[model samples]
Target chain A: MSWITDEMRGIVGKVMREAVSHPIALSDIRKWAMAVYWPEPLPRQYWDEDYAAQFGGIVAPEDFNPFAWMAAKPTPDDPPVSMSAFRESELGVETPDYKAILLTEIRARHGAPMRPGDVIRCVWKISDYMEREGRMGLMLYTTLS
Target chain B: MGDPRTLAVGDEIPAFSREGTVHHWNRFAAVNYEFAGHHWDDDVARHEGFPAPFAMAPLLHAYLHAMLRQWAGPSARIAAVGIRLRSPFLKGCSMTAGGRITAVRTKAGETVAELELWMDDDTGARLSTGTATVAFPS
Candidate 1:
């Protein structure tokens, strides 16, 4: 049986959620670098401003996620956005039930570096969907970007 | 390995490794704000049919980027990174991420190196594999 539904396919390119982050902070970058490289000293560019000055200034680790927590667009007063994806209900589409959701892959493309005082805006959408047979059973994977 | 400008295909770059411990995962959760129960609670994990709580997928992806940054130096631009998770890096395991140069070419004013990346746990299981591109100024 196919997991893909007409509604799910129709909203593939539509925006499901959008968020704008508050200005990024230096501590935010420092703490992220520290967390990613715990027990070891991170590169100076991530922690020390003077050392980072050689490259311009401090920049967040390229893989940093700005939408990890709260966002300005989806104000704190607004209902929470579930961490899990495939919630087409939010976009007025019904979703098929599944036992568990697993993140199978991640692809990131970088252009400009994220630095302190930078405000970031994110638009979340369901880019694609596919089903594969696995050990558990028929698994449906949704690609959100 | 001195200037990144002389990088050649088949060169294995430095790696970033870390044990699967809450000591480190908690820190990542703090910054990333990922408080998913399955990541730290064995019971929650078992309920999901996993052997044990495992490392978050994003953290594994970040480790690959961390390895790239270590080798590319502060100035090199990491153009892109893509990873496919094959197995969970369960708690108590050790993950080491490394990559080898696959292709190198010049673009505009930068030299970009394409790499084949892999993450293997100490248990000899390949946890994830993917590719990346890092560009260094010429």
Candidate 2:
């Protein structure tokens, strides 16, 4: 039986949205910077009053955009398959048939710089699905926003 | 950061390498709120078929970004970035992140450069591949 069934194909175009309950905090940016070893002088730009003043105030790293949404705690009303849930599923053992799901690719475009106190929002969609033969076996690729 | 005008398509960017540490991973997990067993709990990771706790994919992506941002300089604007994860970067593995300038051109009155980036373990095996575009002052 093909894993890429019509039922699975039907998931294409499905969308989920989420909003950060609070503004992006300076502490959150600092923590992420330190975690990734984002150089010293640059980390200062995220918190230091002097360094950040150059950027019009503390500037969040460009890549930190996605993490802003990740740091947001989910609300009871949020969709079950929201961005947070999708990430948790990728790192958790929730795949169908107990098969492993690997992240093959990721693409992101930077829009606005999220400074301290900026509220964040995220919208993700199931863009496409395909099946292909792989070294391990049949592989199902799902593209999400 | 090097002068963007002087950079050519074949030049190799300065390499950035780091030794993965459990302490660093722990700090990363705490910050990301990622308590996945495979990232911290060795027993669970082994049960899941990994030789040891593996680094999170985002962390590896962050490493590649750091490499790019450092090379691109503070004033340069990163327009886009993409990565393909080839294999898991296990905890405590030493990896180097580097890239080569693939193309350079002027866009919208600004100089832009495209780069092919990659991460390789100490054994020289590629763990991930990536591409990035950055715009600099012409």
Candidate 3:
């Protein structure tokens, strides 16, 4: 059976934009760097106040915006659900019982450098969807921006 | 750091390797609010078809970025990045990130370098592959 129902495909162009609650912070950058095992003798730009002053105060790594804008998990009062999933339910399609939603691909583009205290706004859309066979069974491929 | 102008198409960027650790995974989960069991609980991961808790996709993507930015130095700017996750990177596996300069050109009067980046395990199996574009000062 095809997992890509017309209901799911109907919302392909839907877009959502929101302002993140908190500004990006220096500590967030540091934690991410540490988690990735960023090479030792950590860059002075991330920690040393004197060295960071050269770049208009402490500068985050160039790719740090994603972390800054990550959405917080929804609380019980606010269940997290995607627009496509909602539409699927409306069309009588049951949510799959899969244990994980794997990320098959990602594409990102950089804009302004995000620094400590900079408020971030994220905008994304459902670009496309398709169904294909997988090791388990049918797999759904969805693209977002 | 070598001058961007001196880099050739075949030049090899510096390689970076790190062993995945549970401590690192926990830190990433806390920082990113990624409470997914498959990334932290081995039992849940095994039930989900993974042998062990695996690294999150963004973590692996950031590792690639770290490799590129470290090789290019502090002044470099990454304009774009694209990645395809071919296989799971299990916990405690040693992963090495490296890339080769695929092309260099002047665009909009700025020198740009394109690289094909990848991560491989100690067994030489490719876990992920991607491409990145970085701009250098002229």
Better of 2 and 3 by TM-score: 3
Cα lDDT tens digits for candidate 3, B106-127? 8876689999988898878899
Candidates sorted by DockQ, best first:
1, 2, 3
What tens-digit string does per-residue lDDT give for candidate 2 at B1-86? 86877989988989988776677687667766666678778898777677888777777777777787778866677888888988
Each model's C-alpha lDDT? 0.86, 0.72, 0.72
Question: Roughly what TM-score does model 1 have, to 2 decimal places?
Answer: 0.95
Give per-candidate clash totals: 0, 0, 0
Chain B of candidate 3 achieves a TM-score of 0.95
Clashing pairs in 1: none
Mark the regions of model 3 whose C-alpha exceeds 4 Å error after superposition: A38-41, A65-94
Candidate 3's TM-score reads 0.87
Top lDDT hit: 1
Q: Considering only chain B, what TM-score does candidate 2 achieve? A: 0.94
Instruction: Flag clash pairs in model 3.
Output: none
